[model samples]
Target: MVTSATQVLFPERIYQCEANIQLIAAHPEQGCYVVTDRTPFHPVSHIWPDHPADRGTVVLESQVHEVVDCLVGAVEQESGQLYVGADIPVKRDEPGWVFVVVHHLAESIESSVGTKATLNVDEQYQLALSRGHSGGHLSSLALNKVLHHDFWRKDASRKDELGHYDFHSYAQTESRVTEDCSTDTYRIGKTLRKRGLNAADMIAALPTIADQINQQLAAWCEAGFPVDMRREGEALTDSRYWRCDLQEGVVVEIPCGGTHVTSLAEYAALRVEFQLINEQELVMITHSQPA
Candidate 1:
């Protein structure tokens, strides 16, 4: 096994694990950051930042330190230098660089490297994030279908993972996933206009369109399909995707670099609300919870 950089425990959705601390560093502003040889904590990605960080606790020498945040850290193999979050240079999975999860604490710890450590993930909060992330993906897919049937038929080249008109992919400006909810924002500009998006008519049919999307989500949830993550490798920077088989021969898969629930049963009910701002920006807020 490689020992210089941390290994990410993905495709397992591990909640807690015991690993050795590889490095301990002090940051002037964010307090201290501890790196482990293996971790279950999913850090807030600097590249996307759509889903927030995983907040948990780390035990070092019998002292429990509250991990306020988690972030992606990169190390230079040649220089032995470390860069955290946005400060990191080079794209992820870049050659000659290794990525590690940086657990941020509120204060510094007088610890040394190679110390045995315990990682405890806040299970409830992590579940909430997973729900929101999965719900966001489902909502986007439903929205695409609704728009394709109601507004316009998109060409084959302009389609999403499930072969629906790529409305969300073309117009979405930002997406944020939080506890039991996710918000998606889309900008209706010239590019979207060329793709058959009629801003005025779309704004007028908000209620009807939202109802259609919700109905689709309800049916999918009713099936209680299982979800899984597909990855190319076990490395921290490896390609990962989310896959859900809503029905036989109707599976949906998309590229996602975040966490998700193993089954739709966790989200007994999922719904979305829409709003138009200044006739230019469309906002969608999806709320999900158990029955």
Candidate 2:
């Protein structure tokens, strides 16, 4: 019988583990196999898939199988049956759910249930993602500050760490991080207006708003604030926070599980552009510079 081990490394950091290769089963139709246990590979979260999976190779003996994707797998606590990715029926951390990382192997190998294997990650790609994610967080805070004036009439309902109304939390529909940039989509529908957001006025002055956001981003980048992740514990399920020490005594902290750059100094420049997709939606595109 297979034993489930509690994860040791914090989800925000990359780790290396030597684990047994067990049950590499083909997906019947997806043309891939899922390798179980002991990986440094970070799987794309089923609950929040803002960051993509880490790509690398799984090595055993003299052969190597390229891991094209890494995804979250869950099993029933009582039944011990495994389900991959979106196939999971329950939310993560739900009572009685055991979460695992499913590494997608390119082809079948000769490894057995007890064979030891090594997992290697592409650090270059991981670092690029870290920079993009860090920049993305900062950009969102800047956008919130730039648009704070539009909600002057709302009773102070919620506030971000930077003292702006938490529009990013309520308006955001989807957020994606890429190697060089991050894209965030926000909904400005009836609910937002009901909360006293001037959607029409904001959309009309999008270019000016974008400029203000870019200015804030530039100032933060120039300040070279320290950035890092704070975790409750060194476990996959532990709560993590992305903490940033900005200028003017403003420190922004957001609950986040994704990896990020060590410092804002790594980014020489950051820029953001805005678009009005419809009467009730806005999209922000953010780009970052190299270390």
Candidate 3:
């Protein structure tokens, strides 16, 4: 009965939905974990962990439960064994695994398996994250364009959608999204040098590069380019893409699962600062404040 509704079939895509409670279990360390037949919660990805989990309230009957953390959980096809987050042994979409979003609650409830529940995400927090994520993508593209004419190996096979050398894609190590900003780090070590990037030149031009990136981002915001999210299906494992038409006459499509603002118009200003550390590590800090 907890799994009856069609919406529960792909809870991750539901965003906001009312669904039956499928299962409730006690966790040894993380408190109570609730699995609804359907939900709108965005669980922390075990693979990427970039966008952070969605925070929301789960209302059951008249009592509301605060979802402290949302996480990805998978059950084995043959054994029905459950693994959460880092405990999983295989990659996502692995054969014979059922993926589900697990909402962490502080206390266990005595509700029955088919109890109806409502999922509501905090709008303010979601909006901040959306702006941050969108700005992060924009800043990456701008960074690539700023460094396009120099420092890249002419024969570098990778290129951005706008024909610029894809420095962001090639050198990016880790990216993390915060309230109004995203920080990305890159390593310009021996491997990057071998790939035709002039690391010395990049380090020397850090300030100029930052200015160029900020200018490009400001122009993009002024143009108010359209941003769209493309979903292949409603399932958690389905492919999704963030597509944007830039003022620079380039249509960029990047595979992304996180949420984003509807357009560049939502941002008043988008700026990026660059820092070169240890003569080999490059850090790009992007900040976005919504209008």
Candidate 4:
């Protein structure tokens, strides 16, 4: 039976730690996929796959293993078989499964079970990725606020923290975040138009929209609002939230499963540019400089 889900430490901005090796699974190509009792690695989401995995090295018996990639993984309670990202068939928190962080090491070794191990995440790369995530979120909020006045219809489904039409949540189709950069794609199809996005108007004003979003993002970063994640618990399966205080008395909270830096100031500058790749699709490219 599954007694515990892996405790995730990256949400707390932790970089290094020692933990007991829970399981050591073998892969023909990747070599060893190590699961630890606790880890600072932030695995890419199976559901979204937006933020990239954290990479570094883990020391086992004084031999360092290179962590090529990390993944959200799970083990079947009765079978003891592990499944990596997009391979596991069950939904999260399923009764017979345990969610885990799989540290994909480049080389495989035999007989390391229950061994004490030291995990050290690449701090610089992880911090840069964090800045990209936080900056993307900030850019979305700013875009939502700027578009609220003339973009959506009066009968909007959901609103953001600032009481604005949440175009980011409503229309966003896919998002990908990497080191110091993020790309957000939205579908402005007939359904969205019926729900009241001035698609034609927005297309016509792409440059202006980009300029407004960039200006707003620059201001928000300049204000240096704090960035944080609030977890329901330490378990990898627990619900986590991204929190920020954008303006005085205006705190924004989003249900997010990712890592971030201490504050917006960590991102020296943030900017977003918009593009209309097709008549029915919109894209936003965001970039941030680490401080």
Which tens-of-lDDT digit does each residue in 1-291 have in candidate 3? 212211222223334678777767687776688877666677778899988888888888888889999888776757656677898887667877767778898778888777888887766777788888889999999988888888776667888888888888888889999888999999888977887888898898888888888999999999998788887766566777889988567678899878788889999999998777778788899999889
Candidate 3: residue pairs that collide: 8-37, 15-40
RMSD of each: 1.8, 2.4, 2.6, 1.6
Query: How many residue pairs clash in each candidate at the backbone level?
Result: 0, 0, 2, 0
Q: List the residue pairs that clash in candidate 1.
A: none
Candidate 1 on 55-111: residue-level lDDT in tens? Answer: 889998999999999999997877767799989988876888889898998889987
Cα error of candidate 3 at position 153, Å: 4.0
Q: What is the per-residue lDDT of model 4 for residues 1-291, given as tens digits with 9 covering 90 to 100? A: 233479989888889999988898887586789898999999988988999999899998888989999998989978888999989999987988999999898989774678899999999899888888887888888888888897765668788888888888888999999899989999888877888888788788878988998888888778887888888999998999998887736778888888887787887788888877899888998999887
Q: lDDT per model, in order?
A: 0.86, 0.77, 0.79, 0.86
**lDDT for position 109 in model 1:** 91
Indicate the worst ten consecutive residues by lDDT in candidate 3: 2-11
Q: What is candidate 3's local distance difference test score?
A: 0.79
Which portions of model 1 show Cα errors greater than 4 Å? 1-3, 153-156
- lDDT accuracy of residue 41 in candidate 2: 75
Pairs in steric clash, model 4: none
Supply the global lDDT for candidate 2.
0.77
**Angstrom error at residue 255, model 1:** 0.8
Which regions of candidate 3 are displaced past 4 Å?
1-15, 77-80, 247-249
| Candidate no. 2 TM-score | 0.89
